[model samples]
Target: MEHSMYPSMTKELAKQRSDATPEIQAAFKAFSAKVFADGALPKKTKQLIAVAVAHVTQCPYCIRGHTELAMREGATEQEIMEAVWVAAEMRAGGAYAHSSLALDTVNQVKSRSGA
Candidate 1:
């Protein structure tokens, strides 16, 4: 039986992109490898951060990829969940931070209308 969209579609598409542009793909892989390497932060911590960022970006592929990498790098379920919570908080905080812009705009309009 052939399914319209299989569960592995994302992985298959990613592989296709890598095959289509091997050089650029290889460079990205290398860059990501270097970025995630253990330095001031450990590999597991970096993975957790990646997972959090993936959540903030709302990228399903990235979230799955980084969550798996995080687990492989020794991140516990609790750690992963905590990272997700942090992502949620940060997303909300972004909206909260932008409220200042809304406030300023409202004040400008009110002042212009002499209200």
Candidate 2:
């Protein structure tokens, strides 16, 4: 089934681009290379972090891309799952934290109105 959210490029076009667009491919290669260049974190850890960011940002393309890269970088399934869970928790916490401002405003308005 075709997803309506993302445009479906023609298979022939995709193949042709895959085969012929050296510059386009090099851009992506440069991006991936730069993402792993610093030794601050191990490659697997960085890839897992990328996967977690993808999950939190809700980018299907990035999630799929990073998941594969993480696995290729030797991230265990457990590590990948943990990263996803961490992202979920952080997203949930962020939403909950923001709700407090609304609650505080409501409380202040109610106190001012004596209701």
**TM-score (all chains, Cα) for each model:** 0.87, 0.75
Off by over 4 Å in 2: 1-3, 7-31
lDDT of 2 by residue, 1-115 (tens): 8677765557886778878987888898898898776588888889899999999999887888889989998888999999999999999999999999999999999999999
Question: lDDT of each model, Cα atoms only?
Answer: 0.94, 0.89
Predicted structure 1, TM vs. truth? 0.87
Clashing pairs in 2: none
Encode model 1's per-residue lDDT on 1-115: one tens digit a residue.
7775435657788889999999999999999999999999999999999999999988887899999999999999999999999999999999999999999999999999999
After TM-score superposition, what is the CA distance of residue 49 in candidate 1 from its true location, in Å? 0.2
lDDT for model 2, on a 0 to 1 scale? 0.89
